[model samples]
Target: MNRFVRWLSASALALLATIVLLPQPAAAAPIPCGHDCLGISRDAICWEKEWCAVPIEIKGTLPKEGYALPYRTADGTASAPADYTEVREGVLWLKPGGSLQLEVFVEGDSVRERGETFLIEYLDREGRVVATATVVIRDGV
Candidate 1:
């Protein structure tokens, strides 16, 4: 009787160990950016004249509450308010699942110089940079 009881206990322990050691399926990954993601359509824009405008198309899955597109210009050859005008505002908003065309205006003039470069960057809600674009002012007549 004692021997039978010991065998039953050992069998139960072995069964429990096997179940615990079995592999399990992994959990699904978390959705990025609150179920929506954002990106830019292009990486570069060239200006042919003074007061030239470059359109940066906003692409990707827009959030339900809408998103505010933020950007700032960094001078390469184009200096703000000297070679280019200050951006009217920094934040542009878009509706859910919607696309938008935002313009980057470059102040142009008849200055035969090397191509002036400037940078435009888009920021996420947390002020993190999501994408970047370069604006080049062609040097010509």
Candidate 2:
């Protein structure tokens, strides 16, 4: 009787341990944009004298939170405030399932020169690149 009781108690403990050690499945979070969640109307733009506007649209499930879209001009013959007016580095209050616009200015000049090209990028909070748009400034001589 004593041996049977001990065996029963050990079996119960082993069963309890097995149950406690079992791994639980984690709750999965939904992906806001599965693959292509962000989009831009024009990847490249041509501007002369007048400012150019590029439209950006977000497509997919709207996130519950709003994001501040970060952007910067880089690696282009055009210089900020020289070739054109300084573009706003970042935009604010960009909510999910919404759209925004980026404006590029071209400073008027008389000298004939090759068109200048520049890139405008959108970055996440972690500074990761989300999207990019190229602007071509054709000299209006």
Poorly placed runs, candidate 2 (over 4 Å): 1-37, 61-66, 92-99
lDDT of 1 at 21: 93
Error of 2 at 113 (Å): 1.7
Q: Tens digits of per-residue lDDT for model 2 on 29-114?
A: 22223233444434556657897776666555444676555676665788777776665566634466555566766677778888
Pairs of colliding residues, candidate 1 = 50-108, 51-108
TM-score of each: 0.57, 0.58
For residues 1-141, write the lDDT of model 1, one tens digit per residue: 999999999999999999999998443222123355544434445664444444544335667787666766677668887566666338666666444555666666776777777766666667666665667777646
TM-score of 1: 0.57
* Model 1 misplaced regions, further than 4 Å: 1-34, 48-60, 96-99
